[model samples]
Target: MRRVLALLLLLALPALAADRPPRSGLDYATPGVRAMQADDFANPGMLWVQEGLALWDRPGGMGGTSCASCHGRIEGFAGIAYPRRDPRDPDKLMNLETRIEKCRLDNMGAPPYGYESRELVALTAAVRHQARGRPVAVVEDADAIAAGEKEFRQRRGALDLACAQCHEANAGKKLRDETISEGQTNGFPAYRLRWQGVGSLHRRFQVCNQAVAAEPYPLGSQEYIALEWYLAKRGAGLLVETPAVRQ
Candidate 1:
């Protein structure tokens, strides 16, 4: 019965999308939470932003260099085109965090930040803050985009569900005590009441995978990275809401 319902939902996607285009999860936030995200002064996430800014100028381990020493304070929406396919390695897509880590290991002689680390999260929040209101500008490579779309729509795991079954077909429908969300990615590196700290989009993906009893991919894995690009593309026109507060 459940699988039948999922099939029906899959068939209904075109009508569902046309009838009501997806919305960011922010639309599902409580009034209080929404206001928290709206007001930077009131948002706790700013602490990380500040931390990241401090790190940006501090001398790194090697050659006494800093991010600003090279990048010299990105003056515009520089990172908007991130997670891009590496020119030398077209199959590998590199996001801001990966680039940062590469600089640390190769240039600064520093260790990579562990997943969800305070320093890493803060830095990502700060960099993304530079493009707060700009839309995501990732270039869609054909192969990644196609595989990502397939992954987004395929069924798996104990529940036998696809991402589209909830985030696309039954978005806004009730699921237990919470309303289903479109699961958009514009407001990533967000603060969640459940986590009591900022988290990355990949972390959220892990959480969702656990919920469905599906095996979650490792952080920075090609599969999840492709999905991140796909989801970001889905929110092409929505503002990048870094350090966004969520519940």
Candidate 2:
């Protein structure tokens, strides 16, 4: 009887391990957190939103024209669809944030905001706020989707892990303490307690890449942007809840 019991315990070990969920300090599924998931209109991140609004109207660079001079009232364009193919660059599509930066250079004749800069954060927050209450609707162009899918499946870093392994394959499996989510990006510029700061989806990707020991890409790089395109499309039908989220 003892010998039989030992064998049974050994057999169950793998099953128990497989059932465990990945652990993280973040509590994405808490009821309070879920309730705030789609509340961007009165977001606590509105401080950043205000900063972005100011930047939009402030004159800068040698051209001496503000973003408002060209784009008009930012509020008027709220909830407008994005991730459209760049008319100039057919190979790349422009997200709302990217378009705003491009306008800063082309129309406002100002330098692009640095990634992680207050200006960028404010701008992204502002643009995202405009989409408040609207379902995320990224384009599904074949080329863009294919590129994103390829990145999603590629194994990289010392961990030799692909995003799909955890998010798709082992979702809900415990690594230590917390449940794993689908690695969604519907809530961005989120105030992650872990990060202790606000960040964009691309920044999150960089952190994940580093965690797995992969080479980190520069922020706003074409590769990261392509990945964002893929992720945004994957998160389509979800609402945009920016600046106010906690992960």
Which candidate has the highest TM-score of all?
Answer: 1
Q: What is the C-alpha lDDT of each candidate?
A: 0.81, 0.72
In angstroms, how far off is 192's CA in candidate 1? 0.7
RMSD of each: 3.4, 6.9
Model 2 lDDT per residue over 1-247, tens place: 9999999997776467445442222244666655654455534576777888898788885668887776789887666766677888897767666777787787667898877777887877787778766777676687877787788879999999988777766766775776667677766766665775667677888988998999988877667777777877766666776665665
What residue runs in model 2 are displaced by over 4 Å at the alpha carbon?
Answer: 1-27, 31-44, 61-63
Q: lDDT (0-100) at residue 30 of candidate 2?
A: 61
The estimated TM-scores of all candidates read 0.90, 0.80
Total backbone clashes of candidate 2, pairs 3 or more residues apart or in separate chains: 10
Candidate 1 clashes between residue pairs 3 or more apart in a chain or in different chains: none
> Using alpha carbons, what is the TM-score of model 2?
0.80
Q: Model 1: per-residue lDDT, tens digit, 31-145?
A: 8999999998988888888898898888866778887887788445445677778777877877777777877887778787866788888888888888887776778677877
Evaluate model 2: give its lDDT.
0.72
